[model samples]
Target chain A: MSQLANVLNITKAPQPSCQAQRLTASKSLSARQQQELRAILEQGLPQVAQPYLAIAEQINASPDQVLAQIALWQEQGLIKRFGLVVKHRQLGFKANAMVVWDIADEQVDAVAKLLSSCPEVSLCYRRPRRLPDWRYNLFCMIHGTDRAIVEAQIAAIVDKFALQAVNKDILFSVKAYKQQGARYTKKGNCHG
Target chain B: MDKQSRQATTPVAELTALDKRIINLLQRGLPVVERPFLEIAQQLGCHEDEVLERLNHLMTNKVLTRFGPMFDAVCLGGAFTLAALAVPEPEFERVTEQVNSFDEVAHNYRRSHDFNMWFVVGAESAEQVNNVINDIESKTGLPVLNTPKLEEFYVQLYLPA
Candidate 1:
């Protein structure tokens, strides 16, 4: 089939039937196979007609098995997201700020939920506060085209949420010496 | 291994209309199927090769660093932490090299704060993560403020390119 017809068929096509074999796939992936799959996927998908089939070939599995296994991972929350990882900095979102706020323990969860929903706040995580040095427990990253843009988004969030009473600080990034994917802890001993 | 190589990126390279649409659309994620790119092209009203060509161009120019499964460390039994070091200005470069030399250090950046340097250390397990942190402290001769994430409230970040 021509490329156009192949894709056009997908629009009206029913979703892949991988989920039909969900129960079997759940037990099929061994720890070693899981690790191997992770390693393989970290290499990124090939831009091909059958990316999953390509991956399955490497691990001695059928295409349907690969699709089913990946679907299982997504359901189990093992795969956080399965898509494009765009470089925001090159897209003009240079102003990156790690905004940390010391919201009270009782209220931190509520504040974090609200802060995270904002389109501007890209990453929001709650970390333990190191008292006397770092009192901030809530961290949110806002990347913008410049400082002003970032600051405005933050300010709007603060005003909208009434975070004035909360002690906060915005640590702007100066220089990135190294920025790469968090591949895993020690590829040498991932089997453990 | 398509390890997003460490290097300087071209500054805000020009993007065509389709390029932006692809970035925004893919942010939602590709369906797990045979010809995921083809599905994406259909959504954007373009040919599969055109979409593939644009993606290649974007990645080649370092616009899209990755285009695949983003696994969760905790779920995968992997360890990850965001640590900081308050390196004196004069020794910043030396300390950066020391901290970044470790394979565990995923990314290091100079943040404007008392603790000027911050980097994430990833390991296969919690014990290994601690070991990497200890190594960084001794090598740099600076106290490492360890701050592992306690809870991830939200993560998907979409920017209209």
Candidate 2:
């Protein structure tokens, strides 16, 4: 294995969260199934062909059943999206920023609709405002190679959109304490 | 996206308490393994098949947007950043549509502000990240302020509540 891979393998997984206490699901699950689910969530999804089948074997279920159930949940929209986690910065794109805009409340939806469509914008959300201290409501992220290019995009938005009447702020990320999506399984399984 | 768009999917009030509990549990994320759902079932003291059934039900209903691993882009040898633009009231939709089309952009949402369009961009390289920003500038005619993370204190949006 490459030196880095070897290092990664040996490094004791950052300690398991003291929060690893078993959390109860809504309806009680069978003892075997509960153990399987908890282990999966706490560790990670299996990485292999027919991963679902592998899971079934662990829990003593047929592969078809596992596949069917997963499909069902996905169709229901309980499962949002499933994609790979690309560790940013490790790839050398270190610069990161958070840009906020003050879109008129009346036009906010229309404006948000526009932003959400952009693939460059990864995460977008609306948070409660703190008045003059923070007026810009629409938020998005634009990652790039340098600050100048990033700035140019913002300037273009102002000019093209004629957003002179609103306020703006760019909050850049410095040190990422933790960056992971919600587990959607249980609590006390990891540090919050 | 904002809460409004979410409302169209399904009213949270309609979900059963058991559904809510399952949702709450999975929101944090399932185990990272070959058979995470099975593992979760075991821990929850239920049949693995049942756990999968519930998850499927929730996903199809649109109660959960996704269920998967969220990697730290920074750790993966890539560049990512967050930025927002103040879109004009009239041209908001057009500009947002344009921004959302970029392959590098993962997701974007609307906030209440003059510069109200917020989104995130991920790229295989730093240069690509910048290129995406520049592309947005020309495409949407908006100044893309690249807000590189200066100090990430803490960011965990998932709440079991």
Candidate 3:
């Protein structure tokens, strides 16, 4: 398959059944409720015995309502995952690298799947190349507590995938200016 | 003390096995129920209060940067693209400040590469995404190579604590 066609095949989101559910959910919640929920969630879930009840009290909604809304949102895919967002740095994962590869068009998908299954490989995706300036098409992220370990993992990944001849680059992050959850709804307003 | 000295003196908080377990469980996802903590505690064979306490401690210690619902900006009618700029070594800091000045630029990272500065720009529309890239180029006077995901093969991270 062509590179574009290969990408298109995997880029497809969930089927229509899930999409229809998300659409129904998009209109089910009142704008005011969504705004209030978004505001509370943006602050992060409060750690308490009854967290939902706490949210309910703050939003002036019932506990059941808050729980139901969150459940619905998760089902709709509005909320990708609702849980603890660990600071990798704090978890001793100080060394992280974004490895980009110019895999052959036909083998990109198979290579991506193999790379994604690697224990050290955290994130893998296919991005378009910028031609003369940028040539790598496949990207994967590896995180380790030390720089050397991360580099070793990358070397192993290349060998395992038989990408010896492929052009690749490993970009280790030197600084992080900003990293936070995507804010879809404004703090006070539901609409962005 | 100066900023550099203060950072050097601060001790890194250690993670216990229980803390690791908590992180592992939470990463999978918090149960969608009225008393999710209770369920977690039950599974871990601990009390609900203990689970709550550890979570509170983790948040306080900054082990977990956030703990809540993660929204997909694209699904919510927003556009997001990953772009990078090959900034000159001397002007890197100034370019970083200029690029980060825009509200649309969500995550910016200084990576080791010719195209060194990488960031994600999220906006309400495709037009805004393009505009942000243009604005960054104008401000930094560097060519911005936009490499938005043509396709996402698999996007997930499961870091075992």
What DockQ, between 0 and 1, does each candidate earn? 0.44, 0.04, 0.51
Output DockQ, candidate 2. Answer: 0.04
- Report lDDT (CA) for all predictions: 0.76, 0.52, 0.74
lDDT (10s digit) by residue, model 1, range B1-161: 22233223436778998888888788778888878888988888899999888988988888887788866656556778899998999998799889888988866888999999988888877899999999988898888999998777644566565
Selected candidate, larger TM-score, 1 vs 2: 1
Assess every candidate by TM-score.
0.82, 0.43, 0.83
Report fnat in order of the candidates: 0.68, 0.05, 0.60
Leading candidate by TM-score = 3
Off by over 4 Å in 3: A1-29, A177-192, B1-11, B153-161
- What would the per-residue lDDT of candidate 1 be over residues A1-192, giving only the tens digit for each residue? 242233232211111223322333456666666667778887787767678888888887777777877887777666666777666778878888999999899977667777766778777888999988889999988988889889998899888777788899999998788775455733311111
Model 2 Cα lDDT, one tens digit per residue, B66-117: 4554323333245666656778989977986798777666446555446567
State candidate 3's TM-score. 0.83
Interface CA RMSD, all predictions = 6.5, 14.8, 4.8
Q: Alpha carbon lDDT of residue B157, candidate 3? A: 50
Error of 3 at A3 (Å): 22
Compose the digit string of candidate 3's lDDT tens values, residues A10-121: 4322321234234544444566776787778867888887888898888777887877777777667667666665667666687879999998888777778777767787
Q: Which regions in candidate 1 have their CA more than 4 angstroms from the true location?
A: A1-36, A180-192, B1-9
